[model samples]
Target: MLNNIGLPGLLLIAVVVLVLFGRGKISSLMGEVGKGITAFKKGVSDGSKDDEDEDKTLADGTAARDVTPEAETDQKKV
Candidate 1:
């Protein structure tokens, strides 16, 4: 039923919203949205750097490190 809101209808809606919440309130809300987007981008780049640091392999073409416990190695001797 909402497929018929043409240009005039949209303008009426915008006028009603402006009357209800003035101009200053809307501008401040948009400024907060811009800050949120910048912070999200920075967080994603930092996480990628941390992941790369943990994945470095040895220069001689071996695994990064051995994770086996000492007890597990002794059990293999039996």
Candidate 2:
């Protein structure tokens, strides 16, 4: 039953939708859709970068941590 829609039928449906919602509303809706797709892509890329950083470790087989003031002073005295 769904296969019965020909090009003319699709065009009529599109025309009716356009009439119901003006051109500006449809255009803004499409713009929001585009922004959402872009944000999703960016989030996926950032997540992969974080995973890669976590995989890195020091030569002692322990995970790396941020340097503290005490650790820095001890290293300097040594």
Candidate 3:
């Protein structure tokens, strides 16, 4: 449905938005959007670094927690 927005149509929309919200308001909104994008990128990179860091403990430099379950006989009656 959005395939029909030509240059003039886009311009008209831009003009309408500019009229509804003045230059200062739009500028501040854009600035906030820029900051949000930057923060999102930073968060994604940090998350990847955290995933890489998870391999920080084995003999081969990778971590693996023990998950072996003990036999029922290993538990004595309380």
Candidate 4:
């Protein structure tokens, strides 16, 4: 069904949408969409950085640090 929509058909649809929702509304919606995409990209980059930080290894190939300070104190008490 959608395959039949050529450029003219798309333009017609866009015109109908613009008529239904005024230009200002459409422009603001597009602006919000752009902001959402930018925030999503930033979140993905920050998550990748966190993964890289967690992946650091010691010279023996073990994880660099796993124990918490509270666990260390408990071990000392034993």
Write down the lDDT of every candidate, Cα atoms only. Answer: 0.87, 0.91, 0.87, 0.91
Which candidate leads in TM-score? 4
lDDT for position 2 in model 4: 92
Q: Candidate 3 residues 10-71, lDDT tens each?
A: 99999999999999999999999999999999999999988767766666776777655566
Q: Candidate 1 on 1-78: residue-level lDDT in tens?
A: 889999999999989988898889878988899999999999999999877766775657566976899999899988
The TM-score obtained by model 1 is: 0.60
1-78: candidate 2 lDDT, tens digit per residue? 979999999999999999999999999999999999999999999999977877786667699886679978898899
Error of 2 at 10 (Å): 1.9
lDDT of 2 at 11: 99
- Better-scoring candidate (lDDT), 3 or 4: 4
In candidate 4, stretches whose alpha carbon ends up further than 4 angstroms from where it belongs are 57-78
Candidate 2 residue pairs in backbone clash: none
Total backbone collisions for each predicted model: 0, 0, 0, 0
**lDDT by residue for model 4 (1-78), tens:** 798999999999999999999999999999999999999999999999978866896557678865678978898899
Pairs that collide, model 1? none
Q: Order of all candidates by TM-score, from best down to worst?
A: 4, 3, 2, 1
lDDT of 2 at 54: 70
- Candidate 1 stretches with Cα past 4 Å from truth are 57-78
